[model samples]
Target: MRTHYRFGHEWQVQARPDAVRALLEDVAGYGAWWPGLRVLADASTPSRRAARLEVRAPLGYRIRFTLTESSVDRHELRALLRGDLEGWCMWRVVATRGGSRVVFAQEVEARSRLLRLASPLLHHRLAGQHAALLGAAADGMRRALADGEGAPGQRVGAP
Candidate 1:
């Protein structure tokens, strides 16, 4: 059986909603701000792309997945995943008193033999690792936005 996982995270950034949405909408641009993320194939539109991501925790590995569906509009963003992992991930961005609040959620089934086999015993550990990875990314985002790195005019298509 495949190992299924679900997780959610919320973080606030001191950036405008449009700025945050612009940053998140550009999947190919992730490698510029998000750590350990690499896009393998850039989609012509803002709606889809194929990527390889590696996370280093107590356990480390890489997975290749195609983001077959994506939507980035005024209020939210979402992506459907396939390949080494299969499921859906989404983000909702809202304006807050100080900045923007981003809510992110994801559900996926592990397709790799190693992950699927060890998941029963290490699922919690895996989840923790995922959370930590996201936490780091959030921190990176705060810095990038403050530095005006993810602003408009960045090259966002095809790596």
Candidate 2:
């Protein structure tokens, strides 16, 4: 049986909602602020984009997922995933006093047999690794935005 996982995170970013939204909308630029992720995007219009992502998990695993980003509004991004993972992910960003409050939510089923078999035993470890990764990504985003990176008209981070 496949193991289904639901992960969510709430992060505080040092940027306004618009700035955060612009960063979030630029899906191709995520590697600059997100750790262990490399994204390749194919798009003809703003409403939808097809992307392939390669992620290096902390446990020495490489996860490859192909997804289609369906919508990106002023403060939200929604996507459907396939390949190694199957399900959906969403992000919501709201303006706060000194920055933005962001919510990242994902519900996915492990399609890899190794992961499915080991999930029950390594659940805690997996969760811990994911938490650490998300924490680091949050810190990276804070620094990137604070330094005026990832925002439109601002300099982009190195490849």
Per-prediction count of colliding residue pairs? Answer: 0, 0
**Span of 10 residues, lowest total lDDT, candidate 2:** 150-159
- TM-score, every prediction: 0.83, 0.84
Candidate 2 stretches greater than 4 Å from native: 40-47, 149-159
| Candidate 1: pairs in clash | none
- Mark the regions of model 1 whose C-alpha exceeds 4 Å error after superposition: 45-58, 148-159
Tens digit of lDDT per residue, candidate 2, span 1-159?
A: 437888999988766677777777776777788887778554325556666777788788877787778777777889888878789999899877766798999898888777787778887787777787788778877877887554434445522
Among all candidates shown, the one with the greatest TM-score: 2
Local error of candidate 1 at residue 76 (angstroms):
0.9
Each candidate: RMSD to true structure?
4.8, 4.0
Candidate 2 colliding pairs, count:
0
lDDT of 1 by residue, 1-159 (tens): 528999999999877777788777776677677776666667545435434444445466776777754666678888888777789999888888777888899999998787888788888888887888788779877877876443334332313
What does the lDDT come to for candidate 2?
A: 0.76
